[model samples]
Target: MRRTELFFPRYAWRQPGATRGDERFRRASSLLCSLLLLLLSACSSISPKETAVSKTGESTFKSEPPKKVQAFATPERLKALDTQEAFEYRLGPGDMIGILVWRRPELSQEGILVSPDGFLTVPRIGNIQVLGLSVAEVKALVTSKLEFFYIEPEVTIRVQEFHNNKAFVLGRVSKPGVINFPGKGTLLEALALAGGIPDQNKDTSLTKCAIIRGNDTIIWIDLEDLLRNGNMALNAPVRNNDVIYIPESSDEMVYVLGEVQTPGAIQIRSGMTVLKAVMLAGGLNKNANAEKVFVVRQQTLKGDVIRVDLKKLLESGDFTQNFSLMANDIVYVSPGGMTKFNYAIEKIMPSLQMLNLGFSDLESLGVMERLRSKIWGQSGFINSSSSGATSTTTTTSP
Candidate 1:
């Protein structure tokens, strides 16, 4: 697969005895070349090989491995508590319950659905907070309330529908819907119930996932960590009302900002390379410094800044200079003479400000909430002892 590159040099090469019509023809040729770049043909991989450009303007393939980046900035995923404090399915909104009083069929209620506000309206009792309480807990609460009105009242409550004891698996998955957990649900179990993640050819893939709980807290979970890396730590417990969204590959956009005609964002397509990204952004103008193109990526804290001499690639057909682009990658084609990194960043900042996605900070998952999730569990279980001490299986995210 050949990438059709049409390089129109800033200085037109002409003969000594050139006519006025000859200059017009050269201008016409430049216009035609620029138009051809719009029909770009891209070919690259997701994890591109590291090709570093030296300060002396030479492309060198590094032997060292690529830096390991944490998918989510937070260090650890949530851990489960001991079996003694095992996770019990708690009631939530939309859950249906059946209440029966001993020798009092008239006072009993059947299939009473919990309201969105987490309250259940009973026959005798007006409203009760049934949300986040187990079936055994509900029985105890009902018995106390009935004791005030009736003599030695015995109450038996069972989950009729178990509607709210589920996790929502949304986004680009095979079967996305509410997954019911009869006992306890784990991240892996929910994913399996939702028909697992799908492969969308070479275009877009289900690479990453997130667990959104109360207060819109998002904990980034790497799919690789679960499937390939064997990081069982990522298999967090699925709490009721928890939303697991596995976003498409398009969420990871490639920002093409620089001396290009249409400098903004290009949807990261399959085989998206540096040259293809530049071409898709309406190609470069005459002021574009083809000698020093930069791909500024936010992999780690300091950031991974790689320099690419694109002029050599275009003229000599060198694929080394045209490395692949990953998610959240910034391809900056500087104007002639401005090769310094800081200078290019200064020029690119203003353009980035207009865009919705900011490069200012990494997607930060709060710490205090993590500490809170570590201590207090969904159904008020103390998540103190880990798997080492207890027979705990469900790993959770804080």
Candidate 2:
């Protein structure tokens, strides 16, 4: 057929290369992955430990460790906090006094009110300034003035009513307000007048109470010593306009976690021991390794980790292993094998987060109901019989 070697060409179908949309999608996915990684790194940078108390009683998490625990005021130091000079009640304006002269009835005066200018008009002596002077000083001044009239005049002055004096008791007390003292009052007396730190079992911070005087001077009052140890040395005499502040509990907490039946923070009280705290946490769980209980105490910036053999303390009667716990301490009961500190912390993080959420708030958010439903499932409490039928019918009908 001489068809010019029949020029025929064979064609092959080939797969298409990557399109523009595919490249764009790949870039977007890479960017999304980078953003997710960045978010994870940011979250991981936050500190896991919380030490400061929030208004909701939740601890504020901080990256930096707390400063070392400062030594408490010693007995000698606290005793020396009182002023060396004895406190003497001084007369001021608006004060009513009784001036009596024994055997000299004519010169005795009753209900002699001190003038607004702090002066008292005597029978013979003219107006004399008694303001800013103690009772004894006023008596001596009046006696000196009466010396001109009698051979040796004897004068006695007594405050009939204290009108110009007031003390304030504020912060975390049942009754917080201005308190008027009949005469000289002590720190303890003022505290009693203010209802002695509201809810002594829960809200009061006995170790952090303070007595503020004037504008700048502040005296720390260790109620723990005064109430628990019976050391009244720090109960200094309260002066006029003095303010006693009983702050709410702050660091008075002990955290129990890891293998405890109830893992959470427990309020600390006087003479709180590891055994007591464990019991307060509903005792150890079945998986708890009673032999290796750890107590991490924050004595300073760096915490002190104490290893306790609860097995020895409970079974062998070695009480030395049952140590007294301090405020802001962390107790962790291991799970049989050797427990790493970081692993224990990881295990406790969930409990701390739960505590931070606050049970009341969680209940209000219906989380408790959801949790209960999950626990009971469909067969237990959350009935899935008629409800299940209704759901199936609705889905099938739709």
Candidate 3:
């Protein structure tokens, strides 16, 4: 019976079958791998790469993406910018006037720092009220008065102080202060006198500078265009009391710290948002908790600290939450586990060291010793490298 069963078992059971199941498994694995590779390739291909100060968050701040200025400028405005006026010297208070009468040397004299009462002291004419009169008018007045003494007094008035005509250049200039005039100076000339700008400086544009007059702030002047492009019109005539502010390039940067693939300061170019800034930081790490992206922004006047959720902004282009960043903004991404504390230590240690150095220096010299410092104490010398007392003492002792 066992021999009969053994012979019968070799029938259909021993027959070779098709490997369809094996083939199906292999095909599914291939498709999944292909899909994964395609996804990776797609990701690899995605190479991610302001004009005036506007009052409101409107189109006024919109820059026409940077193209050559030749193509970007409006023809109408270009024409309007080209007009220049003849230099007309006007007389005002504080102007040092040099009056020269051709024949009458005794009558000719120099007047400086016109009195608060707006009068200039003259020999025979006594105190002449020449404050509001033009140079030509002053000349005529002086000539008419001198005619009593002699025939046809040739009077010529040259200004020295140029008091009324001046510009105030503040903020980020090599020298941020007032630049006075009657050298018939332009905005360019004024800026040059202020040490031209620092190399590590920022400006509205290479050539663009600001001109603030009273309540009005007119911006977007191309200094380079005025110089190189032979666009004399763009070199707008500067007026008295004009405030020119050459603003630093948008300090708007996304500061990356802790566990970032490329952690550093990423500049926030135009149309850039939090998400764009993040991507520029070489995306998040494997352990990065994307949901915990916090933007620490200081509020206006109130000095309130606001935290923004960049994860939500990235998922959805919610620019409202992607608030335009300002200068000195710190963008922080909390790291996984130990990196968070590590980041804090790395950042704070330097600041603490600096503070320590400052305190140590202060402590090294006793309070009594510091107070005993003579010239610095008296002169209110806070920023001098050497104390005035040291020099004076050295001079006296020697």
TM-scores, in order shown? Answer: 0.48, 0.54, 0.44
Question: Over the stretch 170-198, how does candidate 1's per-residue lDDT look in tens digits?
Answer: 98779999888876787889888999777
lDDT of each residue in 287-398, candidate 2, tens digit only? 7899889999876667789899888887778998788876788999888554466567887686566554454343444333333443333221222364444121111111
In model 1, which runs have C-alpha deviations exceeding 4 angstroms? 1-75, 80-85, 121-123, 202-205, 251-295, 298-304, 307-325, 328-398
lDDT of each: 0.71, 0.71, 0.60
Q: How many backbone clashes does candidate 3 have?
A: 3
Top candidate by TM-score: 2
Which candidate, 2 or 3, would have the higher lDDT against the true structure?
Answer: 2
Q: Candidate 3 local accuracy as lDDT? A: 0.60
Global Cα RMSD, each model? 32.5, 17.3, 32.0
Model 1, position 162: C-alpha lDDT score: 76
lDDT, candidate 1, equals 0.71
Query: Lowest summed lDDT over 10 consecutive residues: which window, candidate 3?
Result: 389-398
Instruction: Count clashes in each candidate, considering only residues at least 3 apart in sequence or on different chains.
Output: 3, 6, 3
State the local distance difference test value for candidate 2: 0.71
